[model samples]
Target: MKKTPHASPAAAAFVLAAALLGAAAPAVARDNPVDPVSNPDKLDYRDVEARRPDFKEPFLRDGVVSRPERFREIKPGITQAQVLAVLGQALKQQRGALGTEWDYHFKFQMPQSANYLVCQYKVVFDDSQAVRSAVWRRRQCLDLLPR
Candidate 1:
């Protein structure tokens, strides 16, 4: 059988695919340079620094602290595996301050949502350079409000 101009299989398939993909594509999120970062309101670091609320943390654990049920306790010398084990259960972030005195913060995102909260934990050591208290210290839940 000869294919008609209006009944071309290639064109029909193209049209069907385009229609179906067009309907489904909007549901996906595209992150291009043109695309704005999600949740501009949630950007709090700048705001916090701007206000300059004395960064002085008197106590070792100044912020909220939650012990992970599944993660293991911080033993005498924290290795990447120990830290990663807790992080694996909690949030994920770019590994930083590997040797600095800076607080290692992780952003644990909330239930399949765009919400991200901060969890702060520092690797501490004694004067003898022995890791005496290296654990997840303070965790400030950024997305405390209802979704």
Candidate 2:
């Protein structure tokens, strides 16, 4: 067998440590306080109950399916909130993506773990629509609940 290029253990450890140190870190959310909408008196329950949630807003949730089984390794019918929770962590790490908004078609993928759901969409935009009509994949599932 031909001798492979061998790195000394100390050199390898230093390289690995430096590589990790150089990696981009996720930004933390600011702790500034803001008023909550749940002031109680701010809403009349009777009136609020009569109104429907607006679906036209961007990033507003449409629905969720748990562990949908259409894609390879994704479970079926996972909820929208669950998907968002998983993706949100990844979004913090990646710099290229400005934001993500999705409407689940609920293709019914089954036997998926609590993590990793594929969302299919028509378009993506950044700060401006600089990247428009661009379809892509978003990695989620860091905090996927144990099935």
Candidate 3:
């Protein structure tokens, strides 16, 4: 009679864990597919609106004004770390690294007026986590750009 060898208890546990994790991988990927966008390289507010019809900008915080110059620094292909350096942290509503979109509430002073215009800024990231495009919720916010 030939004797059969058995896996050690620790080795068996490791194999079981590996099998369970391997089985879950596909389902996880399917459940959280990367979001797709039209013209990912040139996404705009219209695309955002099309994908998030019910999305609304959060209320602006008092005394917190975003500099237009800093916003100008945000360009396509920039990394998230660069964005953080330029714009600080995004709004709490943003899902951080787990999400592809980061939202910001910006308030700018109206030229020669006491009131401030609040705009929502959105930064879209590609699958590689690089900035793909940026847009403002309102078209009028473009006026903030320096001529």
Candidate 4:
């Protein structure tokens, strides 16, 4: 019978390292565009709004009363997977690996009244598919955040 050839120790190690680095490539490729010194409130929302017409659902137009706590969990530099964990999938947009933005409609219960305020939320991603910034169509909706 013919004997099988085994890889040398150094070759085995090189192959292992390559495999590990390949596995980590996706995470390493994510880009963080947030400027730590700037106000998060100032992020531009127009870019997301420009794509609003792509969605077919009216919920994004009318807004839904979602739990305010979930929105608060989102932060800059997080990966799309993390955002998916916090907010689940975007309401009506099909977010692919190359998609640059995700949109949502959220309404919050007022602090002292029964009225619910409708708001549009947008999350923008860089070409690397990492979270760049998040914005609200109604700036006042930020008040819903817990102090």
Best by lDDT: 4
Clashes of each: 1, 21, 0, 0
The predicted structure with the larger TM-score, 1 or 4, is 4
Could you arrange the candidates by TM-score from highest to lowest?
3, 4, 1, 2
Q: Cα deviation in Å at residue 104, candidate 4?
A: 0.5
Candidate 4 error regions (>4 Å):
1-60, 92-99
Error of 1 at 9 (Å): 78
Candidate 4 clashing pairs, residues 3+ apart or interchain: none
Q: What TM-score, over all chains together, does every model reach?
A: 0.30, 0.17, 0.54, 0.53
Q: For residues 85-119, could you state the per-residue lDDT of candidate 2 as single tens digits?
A: 54322222223333333323222232345333433
lDDT minimum window of 10 residues, candidate 3: 30-39
Candidate 1, residue 129: the lDDT equals 44
Tens-digit lDDT track of model 4 for 18-95: 999898786533333333233254443332342567677544345666787787678878898999888878875545
Model 3 lDDT per residue over 1-147, tens place? 999999999999999999998987864232211223312233333122223644455532432586677777888899999999888787743433434888777788888898888776778777787887776655566677675
Least accurate stretch of 10 residues (summed lDDT) in model 4?
30-39
Model 1: lDDT of residue 104: 50
lDDT of each: 0.43, 0.34, 0.67, 0.69
Candidate 2 vs candidate 4: which has greater TM-score? 4
